[model samples]
Target chain A: MLRLNNIHAFYGHVHALRGVSLEVPKGKIISLLGGNGAGKSSTLNIISRLIQPKEGSYELEGTSMLRKSAGEMVKHGVIQCPENRRVFPLLTVEENLKIGAYIRKDKNIKSDMEKVFTYFPRLQERLQQKAGTLSGGEQQMLAIGRSLMGKPKLLLLDEPSLGIAPILVREIFKIIKEINDEGTAILLVEQNAHMAMEISDYSYILENGRVALEGNSKDLKDNDEVRKLYLGA
Target chain B: MQIIVSGLIFGCIYGLAALGLVLIYKTTDLVNFAQGEMAMVTTFVSFTFLSQFEMGYTTSFLLALLFAAVFGAIVHQGIMKRLQSAPPLNQLVVTLGLFMVFNGLAGLIWGHKPAGYPQAIKGDSIKMGSVFFTPNEIFVMGITLTLMLIFFVIFRYTKVGLAMRASAQDIKASQLMGIKVTNVFTATWAVGAILGGVAGMMTAPITFLDTHMMFDVLIMAFAAAVLGGFLSLPGAVVGGLIIGVFENLIAFYLSPELKLVYTFLLIIIVLYIRPQGIFGGTQSVKKV
Candidate 1:
């Protein structure tokens, strides 16, 4: 489980996250829904310790993560599949996947790698191929598969389906659900409300860097304001 | 044929030096204007070991290289690390500043006089039907080739190498995957410094050891790196060899004074015709 209590973050003169709070319970998919500039990515960045918060407390199962560095966050099993699938374009897919487990010293890395291949069989086919050469869909899969190589306890996905093909998006979401079912918690940020709500256990709708609404995904899907603004009902 | 053989021998030294520059630039995005000075200081450190401490050639050489590695790590951790997010221009200025510091420090410690540098090998030039090379030159070539091979193997097969490539391609993404990017940066500086140290040792025998000896070599090495595509390691070696041979041929046929002038002219032309150089990738290399 993870919690962000009354967090405030700023970028120079602009306020990004203003007294924002949220929770991600164990082995659950929690979607953070927002339009542009609603601080969706900032929340994830803070969680990953990429950017320091102006004021807040971040905890992972009661262990304070507020003072940890970005590099340390990954060892704590707080893995992030960053925005736009930032795979090492010049490296082979296999190399990229290996780098994902950079901090782990366990013998299960090879087996975990096989587990990733099972989720994205296409990745195994292009193991030796340069990641840059992969198609957008395949690159997204590589990005997620690479993160899975770290054996994330709490995975933060910025936008897994952005710029992806519709068919691939469906496949990716199906895998996301499967991954959660297998025990890893997920914090998904998306502009695609309908798709995200279909799989997320709970949802938070962010408006202007504030949580405007939060509830069970089903209830949020049927709520009048949530339906009007995000669900496009 | 004589000119070609000699040029290639010298080129190996230049290529080794350029490899250091390229390695540092590829990973940390720092041009390191101080590379020459850093090598010069390490060379002096070895000179002290050989002269003051009365150490053997092998011991002094190894000790200096070890010192260079630590020196590089210190430079990165103390200065370069802080400038990680600073503007490229600022980083450039900092390295240039270090160049001055190293130069002044070496001058104050070793004085301005150039000294005889003992070669790893001592013997007369071996002459064949058309080509001749001294034992030291052969030794230089052998060491350069060995180092290059070792680098290639480590880069291709090691976990650290994979992390380095990942860091070079995407620093933030590599961090997200749990890579201690700072560690990669430190390791890069250490390896680069060692290469520079080897280049310095090889060069001192020919040019004589002085605070400014590596300056001219550094210029040539940069030109070679630019020609080879700054991001490609093999490009650095090829670029160095080409520059070496080309400069030698020019000096043989044309005015000796015009050798460097012509080298610069050639570099300008290469950039004009193919801005990416011979092996440059489509993405413009980040200028250090």
Candidate 2:
């Protein structure tokens, strides 16, 4: 479980997150839906400790996380599948997965890798192939699979559906739901509002660095303003 | 045959020095202009151990390598680490600054005059057909080959090597994977400096130890790195060897004075044709 209180982040003179607050409950899929420059990615970045909020109380199950570095966040089981599948281009697919478990000293890494293969069988077929040579869909799978290798309790996914084909996007969303069903808390940032609302239990709509709307996914999906603005119904 | 053999011996030295430059550049994306000076200082350290402390040649050599490793780590932590977030031009300028500092310090302490340096193994040159190999030449080749083999194994098989490769390829992605990228970078600098120190020690006996001992070798090593494709480790070694033999051939058959000009011309032509060098990947032109 993760909680943010009045988090305000800045990029020089530009205030990116203006008094934004949110919560991700244990074993739940929480979607943060927003347009461009709405601070969706910034919120995910803050949770992952990639960017620090100038003003905020960030807590992971009651322990303050503001002091932790981005590298230390992974050790705390906060794995981020960053935007645009940033797999190491020169390294093999197998090496990319191994690097994900960089902080883990357990003997179960091989078994964990096997578990990832179950989620993305295509990756197993191309284990020795360089990651850069993978197709966008395959790269996305590798990115998600790589994060799973960390055995994260809290997964921060920033725009998993971006640039992905519609058919494969559905497949990835299906796997994302399955991952959440298995008990990992997910904070998904998405532009694909229809799919995100369909999968997520709770949703927050952000506009101009502020939370404009928050409700159960079902209620938000049926809301007239949400349908007109995001869902395009 | 003699020209090629001598060229190869010198090539091994350039390759060893180039290895350090390439390693640091690959991981940190900063071309260390001070690599030659670092090696120069380390050689001076070894000379002091041998002459002043009366240490054995082996002891002095190993101690110099150890000193290089620590010196490299300190340089990275103290200076390079601070410049990590700065612009690439700034980082490069800092290394150039370090070059002047190290060169000045070595001159101040060791004096400007060249000093005779002992070879690792002093013996008669062994003849094989038309070619003759000195004991020191053999030692240099053996050490270079061994270090190359060791580096190959480490890069291909070790965890640290994987981290280094990952970090080199994508720093942000490596961080997401929980890799201590700074530590990997620090390790690279340490290993790279050790390689440079080995090169300096080997080169000293042939050229004589002085503040400017590594100047020509460093330039040749740069040429080698460019020839091999700066990104590839094996490429740097191959590039060094090619430059060594080519330079020697030009000196023997053509004109020694024009060898440097020909070398650069050859590089310019190769780069003109391939752009990425021999071992480098084709440039990925990103869409704006």
Candidate 3:
């Protein structure tokens, strides 16, 4: 569903991603695993066009995303539920969800928002409450709800489990699987290796800005090397 | 006491002007140093309708506001849109350039000589014990206060206002949600420009219309906006009034020459103590 070929990303002089490439098929949960500064987040950012790649070609389905402005990208169905739950903390739960669907000019917004609230019942109960006041788990749910409102065909979720309680992490992973089951392809980046492998159909292990290994999740889970370094078996 | 009464009136006008600045800045994250200039130009448009077009005075004033909004939208689409993702410094310079352009345009169009626009409301200056106020000045304050009320209402009740705020907080995110972010930005500039125009038009009768009239008020309007915590509408209103009354009291008690110095000091002290102003919460700190 998505492809990045020879992508090179930089922050001034420091190279963040050095000639990296990856691909994903349609309607599948693809997990990118890495430690800090492994370019996992950077890959998601490049696909979402939040940060421009110094040199690379990215094709979503088939069209090159290079020529599109951020506003244009939303129409192409590559939306991001950014890390740190960058929900508009000052805005209410409803307002934050409305923001997720900003690029839509359709009259079906009310229905879309209803769908979001249905997916996240906590958001419905706290619709008027400020997002910042919500618990970390609740905010993560709201963030995912907000992205779902965008109705992206390919969603890039960045560390949705980060900073949330462990129990909440499992719940969030279950919801992500539900979202993937509903036909929206997902590119999930996570530090929680076990859950990512559990939910993702295909997984890529990233280290030092390059893909170190790629395989089916069950095989990766059974692999001794991954078990030793990442799984801690 | 006279200083206090008059201070309230002048403060209301400054508050409206500062509101204009804050609205544009909130969305674009741009200080818009040329905001005063935008006001100057729009008010001049009013000056044209009233003096040259021979239209009814009230009608001219209303038309001037419409003209200002349109002018603001044009400037946004043509100029500000290009600078949307540009660095703050570059955007700042663009507005500073606009400041010079608008001021220079005013000078070129109407010579450096200042002109006084006629007031619609006229009556004897009312005296209440130690205070004094003309009916027209009171009317001007009423107009400003009414505009502020309208702003509050629109911001609270309207979908457009909510969308505008959402866009300001997260432009890219808002865009994904199907909000035309460019339209929001344009609307902000339009509101800001119309406000500046009104301030210029109303204040022209109080302080003669000249290219530099708004310039003198720039620092204080900016100070008021910054002091308001840079994001809150109510904060801008309160901040502007505080600065206005304070400046007037200084002029009454001390010397007129020291008034600018006093307001300047107020700004520095406010920023030093609370860099976020009164309402703005710092989120993204741009890399220097």
Candidate 4:
């Protein structure tokens, strides 16, 4: 449901995204894989309207999103669980979740919160606890759960498994697949290429601010160059 | 006993003013050195309403608060907002600049001479055992307590307060949650200025309204904030009271002229003992 064409982004003199383009179809998990400084996070940031691209045509369905602010993107059902699990450290878990649904005026917030609890039952136990006190794994869970509270149509997850333990990482991946199965389209940025390709239907591997390869996830997994570079097989 | 009673009365004013400083500092991470000057200007506005328009004391007080709110919003939007991306040192320097501007403008408009300002309530001191409480003293303490209660309730129970606290803790995270952080900053300044204005109006009757009326109160307020822990609201109030009572005790038992010196000495001693202030957490140290 989201499309970007010829998007070029810059951070001062450094060009982060150099004529890069990608698409996330409705209800599909699209994995964007790359090494460091490959512009994976910058692409997600542009889609979330956190940082505007100097040159691009970005649209949700057909409406342009280039002019919308980050707050407006949330209202348009584009929720981003940013890198580093940026939960409000001083606020309680419950308060953080409430803030997630900040733009909504509906009465179903309580139910939506319960829905978040179903995805991360541990959060229910730590409802009154401050988010900073949560374990890295739990904080990651809270970040995703918080985004889910927005009832997003398009979810942008930037490195959900960055610092998570292997066991918890597997569980998080399982939950991510389940979330997509329930009908929210996801654009995932990941460094764990094996798990990303295993779960995703389509994949794009980026190198030096450009898309170097794009194909079916299964095909890319079998590709020799992908195996040597990203999979480390 | 009478000295302590009067100390507590003045303590309420200092506490209120300190709360204003702490509020802005907590939310914006900028210490408003101009807080006292802002309060001084607002007091002059109230004086204008009372004398020029011949308004009732209650009307003038409420109108002054309204004026304070607008003035605060203008300061934030017109000046502080532009400095958001600047370094913390630069932002602090701008507030110091604002201190001079407000003081200069108030002097130009109201003149430097101190003038008589009326009390909220006019009556004899009510006697309760050995301690005597003037109606104005009672009025100041009552208003301070009520405002404190209202502020606590809003911070703990309301969505707007939640937004403010969230924005204060993490601006980027708050923005991701769809909060308009800029609006939160504006609201914080408005409330902070209102608190300052309240302290100014309460003190004017006793000190007499002048361009520099808030000078002593501002210093004590700063001491109160530092003693309470810069990050803690309740600490500011408690610190103000302690400073207030202690200053009075020093003045009575020792020398009146050396009260300011004694108060700062006490603050330095307290900081040496507990650098975070009584209520401040270790998180404040992490920022440095």
Q: Which one wins on lDDT? A: 4
> Least accurate stretch of 10 residues (summed lDDT) in model 1 chain B?
B279-288
* Fnat for each model: 0.94, 0.79, 0.43, 0.77
Name the docking class for model 1: high
- Residues B36-117, candidate 2, lDDT per residue (tens digit)? 9999999999999999999999999999999999999999999999999899999989999999999999999999999999
Cα lDDT of model 1 by residue, A8-93, tens digit: 99988889999789999999999999999999999999999988999989999999898899988898888999989999998999
DockQ, all candidates in order: 0.86, 0.79, 0.36, 0.82
Ranking by TM-score: 4, 2, 1, 3
For B1-288, candidate 1 gives per-residue lDDT tens digits of: 999988998789889999999999988888988998999999999999999999999999999999999999999999999999999999999999999999999999999999999998899989988789898888988998898888877788899888887888888898898788998999999999999999999889889999999998899999999998998888899899999988988999997899999999999999889899888988764432
Candidate whose DockQ is highest: 1
Off by over 4 Å in 3: A3-21, A51-66, A105-119, A207-210, B1-5, B70-101, B120-139, B170-183, B242-288
* Model 1: how far residue B286 lies from native, Å: 9.6
Model 2 misses residue A106 by how many Å? Answer: 1.2
TM-score per model over all chains:
0.96, 0.97, 0.83, 0.98
lDDT of 1 at B137: 86
The fraction of reference A/B contacts recovered in model 1 reads 0.94
lDDT of 4 at B128: 95
